[model samples]
Target: MTHRVLAAMIKHETNGFNRTPTTLRDFRDQNFHLGEAIPRVYRGTNLEMGGFLAAAEREGWELIPAVAASATSSGPSTDEAFEALCMPLTNTIRAAGRLDGVLLGLHGSMVTASHDDAEGEILRRVRELVGSDIPVVVTLDPHSNVTPEMAARATAIVAFRTSPHTDQAETAERAAAILARTLRGEVRPRVVLARRPMLTGFDGARTHHAHGPMPDALRRARALEAEDPGVLCVSIHSGFSRSDCRAVGPSVAVTGDGEDPRFRSIAESFMDECWARRGETTERVLSVAEGIAAAREWRPGEKPVVLGDYGDAPGGGAYGDGTAILSALIEAGIPGAVVANIWDPAVAAQAVAAGAGATIRVSLGGKHDPEHGGGPVEGTARVVAVSEGSFVFKGRYGTGTRGHYGPSAALEIGGVTAIVTTKNKGIYDLEQLRIFGIEPTAQSVLAVKCMHGHRAEYEPISSRCLDVDSGGITSGDPLLFPWQRVVRPIWPLDPVEGGTP
Candidate 1:
């Protein structure tokens, strides 16, 4: 008998510190496709849904696409938006009558105004509708906060092992394979989770395997699966620190066939390794002044220095309007320095009105929160170029997806040129700069508003990459934000003695 499977994706990584409330328009702006529309847009792409489509074709399974929705990482999603996204998935499952299994693409750090553990709640609703007999397999980002509720509801949870998240398609394929095996009665999958009392940011999660600890942990996970026949899949989640929820921390999930005592031991061992190297995981960041000084020391013949403003990374729910680094670079008169970019719609509008080559006086960036990044910088700038803001990704992540930054302009203030845009986006590709006529390779310094996500693209062309602590909502220092939800007694917040909670 040909098996039928229901597939959908609803993902968003929330940052409680952000004041903006995510709405339905955000999902629409990013991607919101229903049923057949999903495959049409995602087919042959690097997205997780593309993998599901490929798996369906390869396995000869009847695939019923429900809805594929996601928004840029931001503040907690509005209750209405959350319900609207979930309704389509649940409604589709209820109307389908019967299914062999369910496959989902989820970001485990989702937070809505009504629920802290939104992914878990989504799984519960799906479970209530489909019942426990049907296997439910989910593919998640490695940065997810894998909750116990989520682990309990899912038959098997597969997450990307890479930090830059180049393995989205591979992770989804693994989840699809697990679901197929369960449907064929080849294996009964069960997931076991173990978490450490540690909370670290993105710096330590880099998966190059040469310098970072994450690669070693991943190797251990792979070895355990190879050693034990019962082990189906092992995922290590670095967890999103921006999410100030109770389940905010790194964890390890071991999926295996039926109940196995070894699963717990393996998971615990993985968590132990993470806890043991907790100190090495935190990133050592430089201040805006230090970053500018480093740029000043660079020579023209050497490869450009990439200065990452991690605090203002839109991927981590920051406003992307912080002006600390930009103002400092301009003040220091760093020649051939290009910042890609500052999110200021008003300034972009002014530049467009002035047209190219017209000099205009404007206050740029730091408009969202003055207290965070020293307010906006008011100065006269020469508009070098203006664009409607549209480009295609050539990077590992979102390789084929189209990106927009709204009305944008290239402004030259003193010696530094800044790309000002109406919309906020984390730097993911060289195309973001190249489209605006700013060649990153030619510049002496490329200041990017991103975290580790930019490393995949920038590192290849850069002589050196440095993370700067230009204060914003996404600051690397977790202590800067006031926390009310996450469980207490976590590392850096409190003392972790003997590497145990």
Candidate 2:
């Protein structure tokens, strides 16, 4: 019998400390394709949906595309936005007569205004709609906070092993393949999850294998799967620390046959390794002044120095309007320094109105909150260039998608060049600078507002990279934000006992 499977994707990583609530407009602005439209747009992209289509075609399974929606990482989603995004998928499932299995692409750290465990709640709803007999498999970001509810409801869970997440399509294909085997009665998969008492960022979770502890732990997990016949897949979720939910922190999940006696121990050992390396994962950051001083001393013939403004990472729910680093670079008189960028719509509009080659004085960035970063820097700037804020990504991650910065402008203020945008975007590619006529490879210093995600794209070209704690909502130090929801006794926040949660 030919099997029919339903597939959908609804992904968002929420920052609980962000004051602005993500709305339905945000999803619309990103990409919200429903029904047949989903495949038409996403089938060829490097996204998870592309993999689902490939597996369905290869396995001769009937694939039903439901809803595929995603928004930029931001604050908790509004109730209306959550319902709007989920209803299309749920409604589609209700209309379908029968199905052999289900596949999903989810960011495990989603939080809504009304729900803390958003991904778990989504799985529960799908489980209710499909019933228990059908096998459900999901592909999640490694930074997901693996919840018990997610483990109980879904038959299997697989996460992208790479931190910069270049293997999204591969992970999705694996999930689809596993579901196919389960439907064929070749295996009965079950998920075993374990959590560690740690709340750490991705600074040390680099999957380069030679560089960090994350790869070694993943290697051990892969070894466990190879040794046990029942073991299906092993995943280490480092967890997104920006979220202040109860399930916030690192976790390990083992998916295999229920009869496997080794699943629990294997999962525990993975979590234990993560717990042991807690100190390495903790981020050490430099002040903006210190970062600029180092950049200024770079000798000629050296590779470009990349400065990461951790606090202003829009990918971590920062407002993207922080001006501290920009101010410091300008004050230091660093020539050929390109900041790409600061999200300030007002300044972008002013630059557009002034036109290229025109000089104007404007207040740039820091319009969100002064307490997060410093207040705006008022300066006289020459409008070097302006764009409609649309370009295709040349980075390994999201390689083919067209990204928008809304109305944007390149402003030359003294010795530093700043790219100002109406829309907030975390830089993960050199094209973001190239589009504005700035050549990143030739620059002396490239100041980007991002964290680990930028490493994949910039590190190859950078002689050295520094993480600057410019003090914004997404600050490397989690203690900077007041926490009320996350579970207690998590590492660095509170002491753990006996190397366990």
Candidate 3:
């Protein structure tokens, strides 16, 4: 019998504190393709959907494309937006008769207006449509908040082991392979999950440092998978702390070949590792002033000095409108520097309307959360270049996947060139700047709005990169945010039994 499998993707990372509600337009601006368009856009690409296509071809299963939609991380998705995005996936499953299996590409840290555990809700809906008999497999980012409901609904789950997430396609292939084997009557898979009471851990999932706590835990996870035939896959999630949900923290999920008590034990053992190293961090955060000083003092030889504007990163769901770094750079009169993007839609539109070569007085960035990252920079901007802000990723991360910055322009102000963008996207690929007429490789200093994802592409072209905790919602420290929904007595937040962190 020829097996039929359905594959779909709807990935988003929500920042609960962001007042801006993520909408359908946001998905469209990034990458939204339904039905045949999904395969057309993603085929042979580095995205997870590309892996799904390859798996189906390898397994000789009839591939059914549902939808492929993803948005750069931002505020919690609106109810209407969430429903619209999920409808295509659920609808495809509802109509896919005699479906043998389902493969999903998802980010585990998604939070919507109606659902905190958005991945769980998606699985629940899929289970409702397909019933429990059909094997379902999911691919996730390492920064997912692994909820109990997600484990209960899916047969098997896999996550990207790399922090820079250069292994998206590889991770998807792993999950799809499991689904194919299940359909072929090779194995019965079930996911068992375990988590500690901490709000965040695993050095925020940074695998750049090979000997870090995350890497150590992953080694053990891989060892467990190799040792036991029953262990299908072991996923260690560092969790996304920007989300204000009960399940918003580090976790371990062990996908066992069948029901067994050992799966939980294996998961718990991994969770123990996560708990023990809850206070660890991967990056040395620098103040805005210090970061600016470093950039000013850069003696450019081979590569540019990159400063990670981490606190206001769009990747971690911050507004990305923080002016702290840009302001400091301007104040220091740093030359040959470019800030890839400042997410101020209005200012971007204004610049585009004025066209290139037009000089205009503008209040740049810090409009969203002025209190956090130095309330806006006021200056006369010379519009050097303007663009519709669309390009394809050319780096190790998301290669060939198309992205849009909406309306964008390179505004030269106070000896600094700031790329003002209507849409917010983290700099995973150098093309994000190159397309906007700002070649990062030739610049003296580059201020990128991302945490770890940028490392894959940007680090090679940088003399040194420093994480700048130029304040916003997505700052490195989870301790800074006011707790509300997370389960109490969590380590690093509350006293661990009788001891302190």
* Candidate 2, run of 10 with poorest lDDT: 201-210
User: How do these models rank on lDDT, best leading?
Assistant: 3, 1, 2
lDDT of 2 by residue, 1-501 (tens): 889899999999899888889999998988788999877887767789988988999999999999999887889999999999899889989998888889999999999999999999999999999999899899998878889999999899999988677788889998998898898889999999988767862334567435556878777767877787788999778888888998988888899887566888888877777766676743358888789888988778887899998888988888888988988888888778888888999999999888889999989889887788778888799999998888877788866666789889999987689999988899887888888888888988999988767877887899888889899988877778898788887778887786665
The local distance difference test score of model 2 is: 0.85
Weakest ten-residue segment in model 1 by summed lDDT: 200-209
Question: Of the candidates numbered 2 and 3, which has the greater TM-score value?
Answer: 3
Per-model TM-score versus the true fold? 0.97, 0.96, 0.97
Selected candidate, larger lDDT, 2 vs 3: 3
Q: Give the TM-score of candidate 3.
A: 0.97
lDDT, each prediction:
0.87, 0.85, 0.87
Model 3, span 252-363: residue lDDT tens: 8999988999998989888877777767776778988789878877874657889998898898898899988898888888689899789999999999999999999999
Q: Is candidate 1 or candidate 2 better by lDDT?
A: 1
